[model samples]
Target: MNTCFSSYRSLFPVLGDYVHLASCSQGAIAQPISKAIEEYHASLLSVGTNWEESILKVEATRKKFAEFINAEPDEIAIVASASDAISAVATTLSYHHTKNRISLTDLEFPTAGHIWFAQKHHGADVSFIRSQNGMLPLEQYEKEVTECTLLTFISHVSYHNGFTQNLKKISNIVHHKGSLLFVDAYQSSGQVPIDVREMNIDMLCTGTRKYMLGIPGVAFLYIKKELAEQLQPRHTGWFGQEDKAKFDIYNSIYAYGAKRFETGTPCFISIYAAYEALKLLLNVGVEHIHSYLQDLGKFTREFGIANGLKVATPTASSMYSGMTPFFIDEASKVEKKLKEKRILVSSRKDVIRIAPHFYNTKEELEYAINELVQLVK
Candidate 1:
């Protein structure tokens, strides 16, 4: 157990009940989130449907999210979900002529890939790059992304197999070919540090759920300042108006920057919880969290493999994110066995994915790994 996160464990009541290693599927709720929801209900009762705080929460959460990613508040837009964020960006692209091609990998979560794939309806020549051993090689991206490519979508980390990619390397390739890079950080954001400027990313989106330590119904889309000014998404709604608070019912002019991507009303309750969770995460420091996860994940993969469980995460320990997928033949059986022991973990197809958060203990993971070995035997 890392003594560093031990003190903060009490903040997550989920820790009290189960050995939570399912954060990759759905993060265990923290104590602050429950308190935030109670406050939301109280405020709703007191204010009687007034939405001033709701509006403020949407913006404040966006700023906090931007701070976590090292982006400007103006560059971030609060979205309803990851799918909504990707679709908004997809709708903005002009899929007209030879430059209408979009490239994505087979490993990307469907939310990130499907929207662009559907762009075929709008005349986008979508290209799918194959992955080798659950990871995409930089050479494959360079080959498919050409001068005619309008955008290339890549996942910061694979949700299924826990394979992490080098966005900086991929970004340089896409840019050299005169195309923009859009990243789906849903699996990477809070678990790892993201600096859009450092990665030279054109746009990106991630939800509050999963590694972010928040519930569903809220997400963020980050657009580079220059791209936000030039792009206009067909997915715009009344909230995207130039002066939204002015309540101009007849106006069509969109707001400047990433706000132009925002649609209708937001789910403020979830945003409030997300903000508190991010505040705690920032205080803990993403780099420190990444380091800790690396240590734990390495131990998990090494021990699990040595004991005859096939591990599917990246070979490089740094490439291993918080999650490690143990590719067991009887993954479903193993998952059921773990739950019966009051140790919670998840399985995706034949893969039993183990994710340990900052609040989790080394003993919990060791127990889970040993249980998995015995189940397989």
Candidate 2:
């Protein structure tokens, strides 16, 4: 066990009760996050919904998430979910004759494809790059993404098989063709170290419900300042305006930078929880979390393979995210059985996802795997 990382497990009381390895679906709630929720409730009862304090928390959380991704606070928009963020960006695109193409792949989490495809009515020509043999090659992007390609959607890590992508390499390919890149980092944000500037990302979105250790209502969207300034989102509201307080019915003036993408009042309670949750990640450091997960992911793959289980995650450790899935018969049923045994996991289609965090111990993983082997056999 990595004592330095595993010691933080004490902060999550659920870990002491259950072998919680479902960070890919919903992270185990930490004590600080619980306390933060309590504080929100208490404030609601006392102050009776203070907008001033809520707005402060919203900005604070936004700033923390920006720091997490090495982006400016002005570049980050605190939206409802990754879906909402992606949709807001989608509406801003022109999709005219010149740059009418939108490139995507099969690995995206349905949300990207659904949102982008809907733009077909607006003169958008959407195309998909095939992920040959469960891997998305850079050459595929080079071949499919032409000068007419307006935007290319890339999942930082595949939710199905934990196949991580090289953002820097992909970004280079997208830029060479004069197109924009939008990354869905929901699977990789907290567990993987991401520097948007270093990777030359044009836009990105991630939700807090999974590895971010926060709740479902809040998500962060990062758009480069230069790009954000040019976009005018039609799917916007009062909050997206320069002055959320001023009720100007005649004007549609958007807020400066990424804030322009925000719509209506955000979920303040989730903002409170997200603020504390990001603090925990920043305190521990994402680079260290990535390093620890690398070894843990390797263990999970090897152990599953050794136990006669078909590990479906990517072979290389570097490509592994926080989750390691296995191709099992009746995966959803197996997930229920694991739950009956006080072991939690996630199931999607034919695979059972084993998602761990920095606090998960080696013994816990071994025990879970051992129990999983018994159930499947």
Candidate 3:
């Protein structure tokens, strides 16, 4: 056991009974989450409406998440979901005028692309770059991005196959073309390290549910400082106003920074759970987690290759994350087979996806691989 991550194992007692390799679909719930939920319920039962404590914890979690991504606290906004977060950012932009094209990839999760695609009614020209073999080549972005391109939207890590893209290169191209870059890090945050400043990301959205070790109904959005301070979102409420407590009907002064992007009251329980998850995941640190997953990816990739399994993820070892989707006939049935053996994974289309977190042990991976070797063909 890695002493650095051994502390996490005790928190996640559920892993002892099952070989859980589906962290991408939903992360494992542990002691911290249970305790956080218990505390949330206790507070509701006692005070019922005292939101000051919960609000403070949300702010603290924002700072911690900012630290994880090397971003400023004010740049982060707590959102209801990734779809809402990206949509809020979308509402702030001008799509009717010059540079009306929105460039995105087919590899992105539906949540990320749906928001942009819906903009077609508003005269936003959306172009989707298709992937040839479960991975979008960087050149695809070059082909998609043009002078008329207003923004380049892509996933930091693909959900289906766990292919991590080169953000710096994409960001550079987007900037050189005088366009903005938005990254959906739903499959990357906590499992990978990111520096928004270094990567030149204009905006980024991710939820605490997937890979962040929390439940649904809560997410965070990082809008670059300038955009957060300047651009005004079309959809917002009192929570986004400069003086939310004042209750002034006439005045509509949006708050500066990411706070302005917020709409209404947040899910307090979800916020509490997300805060706790960030604390636990940050303990292992993203750099260490990322490095550990890379090694595990190498192991899984080799195991998959040796077993005559078809790979849907990146062939290059360095680009792999915790997720390794093997192409299997009747993947849903194959997943059922693994489930019969007390292993947990996910199936998308014909691909069986396995995502192991830092808490997962090598023996568990080997055991899962052994079972898969028989079931894959």
Best by lDDT: 2
Model 2 segments beyond 4 Å from truth? Answer: 316-318
* Best of the two (1, 2) by lDDT: 2
Report the candidate with higher TM-score, 1 versus 2: 2
Choose 1 or 3, whichever is better by TM-score: 1
List the lowest-lDDT window of 10 residues for candidate 2: 313-322
Predicted structure 2, TM vs. truth: 0.98
TM-score of each: 0.96, 0.98, 0.95
RMSD of each: 1.5, 1.1, 1.7
Q: Which order, best to worst by TM-score?
A: 2, 1, 3
Clashing pairs in 3: none
What is the C-alpha lDDT profile of model 3 across 165-282, one tens digit per residue?
A: 8899989877888888999999999898899999989999999877899999899999988888878888899878888889999889988788788889888888889888988877
Off by over 4 Å in 3: 1-4
The predicted structure with the larger lDDT, 2 or 3, is 2
Model 2, residue pairs in steric clash: none
How big is the positional error of residue 212 in model 3, measured in Å on the Cα after superposition? 1.0
lDDT by residue for model 2 (231-332), tens: 999899998899977899998898999999998889989999999999999999999988888888888988889989888865644567768999989999
Candidate 3, 213: how far from true, in Å? 0.9
